[model samples]
Target chain A: MFMAGNVINIFKKELRTYFTTPIAYIVIAIFLVLTGWFFFSTFFLFGQTELRSFFTLLPIIFSFVIPAVTMRLFSEEFNIGSYEILVTLPVSLNEIVLGKFLAGTVFVAMMLVPTLSYAICVGFLGQLDWGPVVGGYLGALLLGAAFTAVGLFASSLTKNQIIAFIIGMIVCFTLTMVDKVLFFLPESMLGFFQFLGADYHFQNTAKGILDSRDIIYFLSATFIALYMASLRIQEKQ
Target chain B: MIEISDLTRYYGDLRALDHISLSIKRGEILGLLGPNGAGKTTLLRILTGYLAPTSGAVTAMGFSIDEKPLEIKKFIGYLPEEAPLYKDMLVYDYLNYVAAVRGITRERKTRRIRELTDICGLSEIMHRSIHELSKGYKQRVGLAHAMMSDPEILILDEPTSGLDPNQIVEIRDIIKVIGKEKTVILSTHILSEVEATCDRVVIINKGRIVADGSTAELKQSSELEYALNITLKGAEGQDVKTLLSPVEGIKEVRELGATNGELAFRLVCDTAKDIRDEVYGKIKQRDWILLEFTQEYKSLEKIFRELTKES
Candidate 1:
């Protein structure tokens, strides 16, 4: 059983640590600037009242931004030899993995909070449907959650943060592109790759459909990735 | 209290800890003395629940380490060789966070922090970021972090390493104070550290317990005295070597370098014997001016060398 008290304590410590340092600030700043630039650059050019351009760019921009947020989560602990302190504590491996995962996801979601203004501004320009707008933010969170787990898992594989970030980018990019890469493969493997493809379901949810299947896909992916990360910690013991 | 039986750990095929067992009592400061790569750190890690042994049964304070690691961890404070401090955190904040993880209540967290600050001599720098502190101060903050939960067993691994001699003594005094209340397991390769602080010593070599006893007991057990240094004024190194060859218990003699014009000879003796009296009587009869004749005590270093070299 994963104790809520231990997980919360670990989460609080990680969140407090993020605030005390410049890492969260730098990451959030870069994410906002890049996403905001891409959103506004295409906002008026698309000229329709939809945030389609923004949500499309969200997943692509997040592939890089989420890695920056999660690279230090485990790599720093291992690099500085503080992983021993964490493991020797009374906390379970699940608590550590979840705490760090939630912290990174919440940080990315915090970065996404400012983009809500983009949705509101489009309302002033024209009649914007709230369904797709809300759907876009939900899509961002779901996709961020899934990518955060992959990045978190990558951080556990090495002690160097830069290598973790590179590995995170590669994994996230692969998950986001499994569908497109399947385009070149033989037609026989289409259903399997589409099921494995992150964008297939992500695009469906971004279109204002909150299908439980898509939601389940993201949740199960997050669970599996976090479980793998926890296994890495257990292996260290 | 802790009892370990048939504890063995293997890193892949290489055995890091052989079949060994020991017991620890409350309020006793035990020093784990061993050469580098002699499984000192591996044993401490097992005791602290950070590393599981490949085969063993370690029960601490009525709990088995394998089945109830969390229960064991609640009672133990472990400081690894690197000290495991978060360099980005302020000393006070790091301690507070660790307290939370240890499940200490909010009402007592502040008081515990204050108490540790005083014990670790961190009152002046509690507000300072860990990265800004010197290595000595970082070590102190690490000490405070380990003691945060008010644990019963405090395990410090090479706590005095990477410090100046003055800092070493400062940390030693703190450990001495901690040992007064809690059982302490201090591991190091420094022999004098055990002599200065520990009540019991366990010397491990080649992944096995080579010796275990008090410091005085270890010295007493080393009755296999080997060498004595002697200096002569009138005799050349070769002449002195020839003069001492036929003495009982004398096995071999070699020049121990020159000191001005006086010839120095290091005479190696057979086990369970003393050749000092024979050499002295012969010198007195010949009336040869003996400048210096002293046999160094068989210190822990010699015992460590002899035991480890044999294995």
Candidate 2:
């Protein structure tokens, strides 16, 4: 069907808008700076040569940076009254949402590219195990996909970009922080709360244990959030 | 061809369009005339498949809007009143994107874009960002985008709302040129625009069609008469009124004033009658000096007011 064409067209336009603006550069700059700090504090000061510290801090970094890259995906269109034009096109709602999601995912992928330098530096410094490094990259991709989906859902809920950013940050932070907070909860409720946390699955995948359940969990969250974004768009119309 | 029957839309408790029904013939330029909040935008949105009607059905080119929305959307190009556009994109890029989404291939996209740019008088601003354009140019860009796919039916909601006088004339001319090949339905409060560009007029009020006919037929149906102002030197008010009252189709008469011993009287006559000859003969026989006489035709404004003022 021609839905593929619509998705590709929308993806190209959205991606171009993101890169031409200053938001993409700002996001990538901040991500690199934070990762550089983590690298220096762990490797140069503590005299460690492993990437475990770097992979450990990625979910926290992505919680903020992913939303920064995706907060304007739909909210800016609504603010400028361009959503009406987008929805009236012959394309279905699924194609539009998927196109925007893919654009946000590509932006996240670009942000992750510079961090490869950190991985390379760590690899050369020590006799590294490439298997766990590969698993860390996969985990980062899954986490970024999940965060971008949540950010897009938040973007669809409001026309104010600041509010969208704040909401996305809050949602992503909750998903990431719930695991540690569950330690203080009742024993019976810890399992339920840990099931809602992204860090649990991300930690498992970071150690080169590619659990099929963790993959399914991340994918299901991405699908449900994007589905909600499409529904929100319909409500807006 | 477009056919709508019992089409109605409600936003919660308020009825935006109330049982509206109409049909548009092929190659017709129909004007939807109404005041503010007259449901013009709602009706246009429903017809363009942007919004679903709460009740009833609309069939465009024999495709039902509810059952075959994608098919209906393929044939229609809609420009909302706000002219929704991406301000950050250049005109060429944005239109090419629209063309692609509308299924225009890359092989013919450039030629179609150039043709639309020239048709809408947007060739000069094709390379500029949309944010840098003025309101008139932005409206033209919206029109050009709508014309990108060469749709069979074009729905424009107040396409010439914010332009100056000269720009309005230019845009109206372009629309006139476009209407030769495609069906257009434009909504506006400017009645003269309806008279100038529309082959048929659909006057709406309170979500209902008050009157639907040609411009001349609507003017005739409003019972609007022509007024003749006459100034004579030797005639009194009673004499002029009695002479004009006895004429065949004079409806009423009123005296304006007497200036410098000359009498001025206004005669209201059915527009169907040409009483200038009768008045000339009567004044000639009376030996009155015929100083000034002018006939004023009924404008579309009066017809609009008369049609919308009723329930």
Candidate 3:
């Protein structure tokens, strides 16, 4: 019970630490500009009112932004030796892991808020289906969370933020592109490889198909990555 | 109260602390004295529950560190050597955050912060970011954070390191005042600070406790005799040695050197005996001019070396 309270305390502290600086604003600004450009280019060239272009471009954009937000989560603590102070507090390991994960998730959620204007503009300017739009938003959130979890894990691997950021981006990019490279493999092995690809599940959700398997995949990835991050932190102690 | 039974720690195969056993009473100011790499930091970390021991058990306030670490942590405050602090946080904000995490009540958090701020002399820098502060100020902030919860056991590792002379004196004064109420354990390589501030001393070397006693008791238990350097005028080296050799309780006498019509000799005696008066009387009776007579007392440094040396 006390551990839960500490987790909430850490969560609030982590969130405040994030928003107190300009990192959150910078991430949101870049996300908005890049996503907005994709939306405009898609509308001008294809004349399509659908969010297909935006959804297709999101995995690529998040490959960069998620790493930026999570690169400092554990790396900064290690570099500053604050991890000693934190682990000595009357808090459990699970609380520490969950608190950081929730903070990253909240930041990702905040970044998605401004993109709502894109959906609003598309709805007013042309014929738009709300079902796929809702699904696309959910898919984008899950995809972002999955990438954030990977970034958190990578950040836990090193004390240098630059190294963490690079590792996170590379891991996210590889996961995002796994499906494309799996095509040359045999059909029997392709299915297993496709399950590892984040874009495969994201595409299903974006097409308005609520597959339980896709939901499980995204959640499992987030859970396993976070679990690995917690283990890494423990090993460092 | 803290009872550490056979506490041992290792970094991989290298032993850091070797089956160290000691008990500290409540409200006792204990100083951990050692040279660098002497396992002072390792023992403090284990006692504070920041690191687990490789073997043995530590029970603080009746709570085992391994069994109930949270309970132990609730009663202990730890300040590492470097004063771990978040540079981006304002002083007051950082203290408040620490207070909240330590489970202080919302009603008492503000009052406690103010009290610690005043006690640590942080009132002026409360609103400033930690990064903008000096090294002394950062140390005070770390101390304030540790004291926010009013913990019973305070573990400070090298609290005076990197501080200016004035700040060092100020911090020592603060520790003296706080030591009256809390069980304070501080580690330092400075011997004088231990003599001045610590009620008891635990001297460690090569990952083991070599000596443990009060400052005076440690100095006495060394059993090493004092050396008195005497400069005599109009006295040959053999004459000086012969006169001092026959003095009561005198162990040995050796002529060090003579310069400028002055002779210098070292007198060794039993530590529990005072042979100065006998030597003075004999020198006066011989009509020799006593140019200089200085007695060198047993220092903690000498005792430390004697205790750590191989038998």
Task: Give one digit per residue, the lDDT tens place, for model 2 in B152-222.
Answer: 99999999999989989998998888799999999999988999999999999888898999998887787
Model 1 lDDT per residue over A142-225, tens place: 889999999999999999999999999998888888888886888988988888878888888889999998899999999899
- Which parts of model 3 have CA positions greater than 4 angstroms off? B229-242, B253-266, B280-295, B307-311
TM-scores for every predicted model: 0.88, 0.94, 0.93
Please estimate how well model 1 matches the true structure, expressed as its whole-model Cα lDDT: 0.88
Q: What would the per-residue lDDT of candidate 2 be over residues A140-224, giving only the tens digit for each residue?
A: 8998999999999999999999999999999998899999888689999988889889988898888888999889989998998
What is the lDDT, from 0 to 100, of the residue B264 in candidate 1?
82
lDDT scores of the candidates, listed in order: 0.88, 0.87, 0.88
Worst 10 residues of 3 chain B by lDDT: B302-311
Cα lDDT tens digits for candidate 3, A14-92: 8888877888888889999998987797586887778888888789889999999999988998899887888877787
lDDT, candidate 2, at B118 = 77
- What lDDT score goes with residue A224 in model 3? 95
> Compared with the true structure, what per-residue lDDT tens digits does model 3 show for residues B1-311?
99999988889989999999999998889999998888999999999887889899999999988788889989888888889798788888888889888999999998999899788899899999888999889999999988878899888999999998888888898888889999999999998889889999999987899999999888777776678878888888877776678777777898888798888888877777787787887888886788889998788988877766666
